[model samples]
Target: MSSLRQALSGAGAVLLAVHPTLAQTAETSAPTNASAPPPLLWFLISMLVLVLLVFWLILVALLAWMRPQLRQIYDLPTVHDTWSGRVLGLLVGDARLVKGEVRDELLDHDYDGIHEFDNDLPPWWKYGFVLTAIFAGCYLTYYHVLQNGQLQGAEYAAEMQQAALMVSTTSDDPNQLTTYTALTAPAELSSGKSLFATNCAPCHGANAEGKVGPNLTDEFWLHGGEVNHVYKTIKFGVNGKGMVAWKGKLSGKQILQVSSYILSLQGTKPANAKPPQGEKEAPAKTLAAR
Candidate 1:
């Protein structure tokens, strides 16, 4: 004991001597003053954990309370060792017992000679109601009073804003090639052909030689023949010319693919070609400027 005391005293003296040196070194070095997040964040985390723990405890207690009843059910001759019977037992406990309990629940007062039973609500229903109340209270506190989360309207607006940003970024990409400059792969052309067959064939004819609409398989175009011009014409459409705007029906990529397909069809002679409806071809820049 004396040796241990002497050793502790020596250690304490060494610590005291080293303390000043350590403090001086620390002061000379960079001061690490990093702080943790706000206490409210930790408080919310703790509350969530507490709520989960409480729910767990409640579930365990409910299961423990129901054990005896379950055992009784399992012991019944009809339900013994049968999965279906066990399920039925859990869903709707012994009808005979329920009927007997209902008799005891009879209320003395009668209205219009009709006796009312003061039976308690089913356990499953009551528990569900209690859980709903708890959920509502928590939702109100977190989303409204404390302002910890966004409401539905705010969340939707935020998502819409994010979507618009994504669209703007994609549209503004300097190196992003349009279908006219980029498309050529066999698969991409095939996709465009399929889209054209499905959407554009009805009015322009299956081979795009003209039916109710102008011939697509020719150099002459009612709208300008430039890729961007064709793209805009398809997107906006001629208001009184019976061509409905396709932009709302098709995505931008789909529109580009279909436009590229139309470009591919130019200069081919058709059996029954429609007469040219617009002015003779002009330069791409001039057409776009219009």
Candidate 2:
């Protein structure tokens, strides 16, 4: 009966350890749904509850079977002396020193001058150790085997993806500058040249001859050569292409200035110019406005 009780207790401990870990993993892996709980998660939870119910029923039956033997023990306390003592008893069960003294029979044989007592492990400490081991196993499997846990690289990637999504979503606001009317102001043009030299030179080339990006010096345009079209393309990038929306990184006014500088570069042939990409634009209506 004692062996059976020990077996049942160990099984119960294992069940308790696995139950929460399974639930947490299921919750994280399952797809989110507003209408109902994810099917996989619901199934796992239901199975866990059923297993727990079976364990509870077995425990109740075992207690009932031991009722006759329990009645023979006349030394049982009517009530714990204090709430703290009751709580301690609930955690550690009946494993404790009798009258605060060790029995001579409980001493073990001396080994190489060292001796030990055969004291039973406290239930709380034993269960805590078991839970720690279970957690360590689950953590190792999650990160190493399944690769589901968010390690440093994965976390950084997720953050970068979220940031890109935020940029794409916010760049479409109507309030943002989406039109470029060509700035003729000397100060604005100077600023625009500086901005272009720093940001666009690497791809478009320093002389706007084009290296990786389309040639700004030529009349040809990939998306349309109009001033407003160029401004819109710069602000909200060309999708599926290398051009990233600069709205998140650059101010609207700065983009306008950069567009103005590019406009200034048109019709002026530069050294080592790349051949035109798209159809030629009908020369943008004057460099002053519109």
Candidate 3:
């Protein structure tokens, strides 16, 4: 027991000496200057890598899903060797290029998963494009440059004003094929009035007072009162509304004269006239004011 105790005391004395030296060295060492970094940065880097890997996997999956259908509908070609192909290459920015040295091998091309045009662009498409260009050029020159045109602004306005004036000034004259002097010619109206009295008086009364057919000369012609409307009624009579086409019965000239005569009754009053039919015109004075 005493021997065992002596051995223990020696080991304790040795441990005490070593502990002081270790403590002094630890105090001088400055906390090992910094231990190696934590594994957390590695874990973060691993997680980033894992997320990227998962993203790439998803992208690959989507591409795989659509690839088969796209493959059937279209053949994905590598860069080609034609004019359109060159344009596409220009648009895409980097395409396969062939030098003079490579041209021979390129020409000897078998189906290396790419194709090229063996024929030229269609003749119709080429000519059509040329025609379109020419047409565009002509249009630009006419509208933007020369201004000599099918319809110029001043000329069109002048023509319209002239036409409208012609229509209005000689409105009563159906056949303006001659001068306006023919307006007062008796031959023109005598036949029309005669025809109206004979054919139309039986239905409408002698003074064109309404009985069977509506009144005429009473500021109210049944179908219409204007020269054009009257002429139309006489020429192509209404069927359902009891007017009949008179083109065959009366000459076009006779119809025109009758239309003119009806228009002339603008101011003349008839006794016991039927009330005004269609849209009434303003009294001539009001019309003139307008």
Candidate 4:
């Protein structure tokens, strides 16, 4: 018995020592086990599904109980006379609900031995006709009698006037060709000179002599010699050439000033002038005649 007790005590000690290792191993594996969904969540989801199933069953049972009573109510004459009931009846293929009942009493007139029942128009059709008449009366009062709304002609005219105003305000059309004579006033010329020196000097040279661009001091112009032509060239640059469009960079007045300034540089004969490339323009007096 003592030996058996000693053996039992040794086994108990061994179990105590292994308990901590087992607990440590379980702790280490806890994160991996946590990947599975919790039991409580699954239980809650199952309960929700059970509740929905019960509710559906109850609803089905209640509908079954009330179906015969609902059919009886639907068959009543007073129910069939109502609009909603008539709509329902029509859906169920009962035309008598919407269309007036057929009468056995025939009219005096007969065509080709066929007797006429003389039934009234359908209720739905009569209602639609009455609604149309009401709409017509309201429309006449609003547009003609009260004169609160504009007629088609007046509305069209108003829209056209608005369109004209919008068009008048917008003048910067790149495709449109414009014409203007050279500015001769001393102040205007001075402004033009200042604008040209600041903007056109890099390419055309500070003295209007040719550099990377064509000479402005000469009568020869690659585009055109006229002041308006120079303005057009400055506003819309040549695509393949080095000329950059100055439309957004310069205002209309500023562009006109620069053009006038360039024209004034004509016949100045700047030093180291580039040879003329374009056809010579007519004399100023003759050009002005056109």
Put down candidate 3 lDDT per residue, 185-215, tens digits, no spaces.
5787777678777766676656666556775
Give the local distance difference test score of model 4. 0.80
Kindly provide the TM-score of model 2 when superposed on the true structure, using C-alpha atoms.
0.40
lDDT of 4 at 102: 66
**lDDT of each residue in 157-250, candidate 2, tens digit only:** 9998777656643547533434447877899989989988898999999988999998988888997777777888888887787987887888
Q: How does each model score on TM-score?
A: 0.36, 0.40, 0.33, 0.40
Query: For residues 1-290, could you state the per-residue lDDT of candidate 1 as single tens digits?
Result: 99999999999999999999999987766444333445668989999999999999998788778878776777789776465554545544544322322445668798998888887665566678899999999999999899999989999999987776666435333223334452556777688889999989999987888889988876667776777768777777788999888878988778777877777776667678777777667433223322
Worst ten-residue run, lDDT, model 1? Answer: 171-180
Clashing pairs in 3: 237-244, 237-245
Higher TM-score: candidate 1 or 2? 2
- Sorting all predicted structures by TM-score, with the top scorer first, yields 2, 4, 1, 3
Error of 1 at 201 (Å): 0.6
Error of 2 at 120 (Å): 83
- What are the runs in model 4 whose C-alpha is more than 4 Å off? 1-170, 283-286
lDDT at 87, model 1: 58
Total colliding residue pairs, candidate 3: 2
